[model samples]
Target: MSIRIWGRPTSARTQKVLLALAELGLPFELTLASGTMGAHGHVAKGNEAFGVVDTPDYRAMNPNGTVPTILDDGFVLWESNAILQYLAMKYDPDRFYGSDIGRFASAARWIMWENNELIPPMHNLVKHTIRLPEDQRDPEIAAASRAALGRAWGIVDTQLSRTRHIASDSWSYGDIPMTIRVHRWALLAGVDALSPTLARYYAEVSARPSFDAIRDPAMHLAG
Candidate 1:
């Protein structure tokens, strides 16, 4: 059965999963689900309404009612990074996920590192600088978060200095999350935020046709 994803298109994580699906060459359906990020099914201005996630019916399928929940055949899954690994392993394991033990571990490592080390600051930066209303925005938090993000991503820059992609010389599923987040960085912090190595890496990743999945004009820069 074709996969179905429930998530608001404006969500960065949702767009990340969409990019992964496109990269896997799989066809899927998308439903607009709302969350703390924005109004439900609000694909454009003045379209906000009660969201699917706010209903008991959606909660019955996935208790969290989170964005980018996927029903693949009978299996249900959420969390964009988890969804990325699932689709890669199930549909395109060798190339996207890597069949070798070391290779698989390598892809997983960077994905985890991205989640644990890089994402906190990136989210903080966005929350302080972009997500909150101007009156509620905190320049101090944004500045500190941006600085922390740059320091953390320095490891990525060093790694990229030696390899073409995060896990290997070629693109891997591990690169998908980072690719999406890097775009967010560029949009929020400015293109100059990237080191030379990171700039090249971003260029290569975005050049891929699958990256088009995250290119919707209505999407927010911080998302």
Candidate 2:
């Protein structure tokens, strides 16, 4: 399969799919489109097509003009979590997605929870705390987002205390999205404490080969 991912490596959404690819040992080309390099240019707007081509020509491929889009053997797909699920089911279905129906549903449940519960608050916190200039940042919004994040983290911590992984005893696509969010949590301000279970889980996931390859502390808001 000819696989290509378009987006900056530092993007949490991009990291989700990339981490899944790495776990599955899938070889693909990565085209950087977002961040300081700004590979896609100003035409795309708002970090769109940063890693992928957003030129008038490339827009024909993905009209939404988003980063972290993928083209696999003529199958074009966007949305980070969907891409992760596709990769797992297409390549290493038995392992990453699991073979049993109950296990697969559980894995899907956590992935959905990450998208719904974790990503929004995490994104808000990162944007207000790190992405925005201090003069422009809103402390009230950041505070509210951080509180929501604490609740989300607490839920994950309780789950981790019971199970080795989010869904199953082994790693699965469910872990990818939240693992990327954990990077933002570690960098964002106002986080005085992290649950011990979460800390241990972060350590284990951070040590993965995929995490080592793409995790970028330099991309944090202070930068």
Candidate 3:
């Protein structure tokens, strides 16, 4: 049976899963759940209209009630990064995931850094720019988040200067998380203010077929 992906296309997490599936040449089916589309087949804005994420059935599958839950045959999983690693390891281990301890650690390091240091600011920036209405958007928050993201990107730029990719000279699970977030960033205003090194890296990764298959700006904001 084909892998069934449960989540909306606009979700960053869901996009990650889709990217991984495409990269691994795996077949899958998409079920729009979350945001405008609820898991129970209801079409409405916000989580309340459908409350799929809060429903007992969804909570049973994913305690967090988050988007992008994958059912691979009988095996079920959530958490976008974990799902990406699982798909890579199961379908295309040698190429997609890092096998060596050093490589794995390097990739893991970026994932941690991204989640801890980078995502907060990035999420805030996205929320301010796209998620929030122009009248309600907080310029202070956006400026602060943008500044923080600039600092984070500087670190990434320095790292990229030393290696062709974020984790190393080659692509690994490390690039996946950053790729999704970075692409979204580029769509926002003031992208040119970002470091050239980061721009090059984004362009290079964006050129990949897997990324092309899953890239979607519509997923970032809105229900």
Candidate 4:
């Protein structure tokens, strides 16, 4: 395989890359490097890399020791969203991503919004609510995340009400990360936590026959 991803399947970020690879029909290998390393299931489940990523060799490839690092046929890339762009641009640009400047910019915008805004609170909620042991769970953080998520998801919900997808009237690469994140969010936050529109949107997106590419039954929430 030309592409090898060093990460766990249950990782949200890694799943995004995996979905992209699946959508593109790209053959690859997964070098599990996080779970046994220290994922709270050892702390990361992304950053805790003892077994695989901590090795000097893995560090040489990914200095940060973060999961989801990709060695794509000799071109090394870290950061999941960046990897998504690389794959889309290289293999199926027009199909998943596009060369059009506006769409490109929009895709970049949504991906950044997901990483910078939505994910922080969403992951916090997940950590406190599910991933952490009952004794370790923090109700305060989970409540705060729920409140913050309302505002963040409101923006996306409004946009989705206006169109079928994030970057365009049709599905775009921009929707991939958001979809993955939203699936997790809904699982933890409950569909009622979302606006009627966003809830409906999630249902529709997940129900799509094409969603199989991104679907993982062992998804953290489902497990």
TM-score of 2: 0.85
Evaluate residue 111 in candidate 3 and report its C-alpha lDDT on the 0 to 100 scale: 80
Q: Write the per-residue lDDT of candidate 2 for residues 148-211, one digit (tens) a residue.
A: 9878888998899988888878877787876777766775642346677877888888888878
Better of 2 and 3 by TM-score: 3
**3 or 4, greater by lDDT:** 4
Q: Which ten residues in a row have the lowest lDDT in candidate 3?
A: 40-49
Q: Give one digit per residue, the lDDT tens place, for model 1 in 5-115.
A: 888666777887888888878888888777564553232333454378878977877788777788998898888778878888888888785676676778889988988
Clashing pairs in 3: 10-219, 36-223
lDDT of 2 at 21: 80
lDDT of 3 by residue, 1-223 (tens): 9999888776667887888787777888986666444432223212333346677888889888788898887898998878877876777666764566677678878888887888898777776666655666788999999899878888888999999998889898888888877787787644596578888988899999888765665555443
Model 1 CA deviation exceeding 4 Å by range: 38-50, 217-223
RMSD of each: 2.8, 3.5, 3.2, 3.0
TM-score of 4: 0.88
Worst 10 residues of 2 by lDDT: 39-48
TM-score-based ranking: 1, 4, 3, 2
Error of 3 at 92 (Å): 1.4
Taken over the whole model, the C-alpha lDDT of each candidate is 0.78, 0.73, 0.76, 0.78
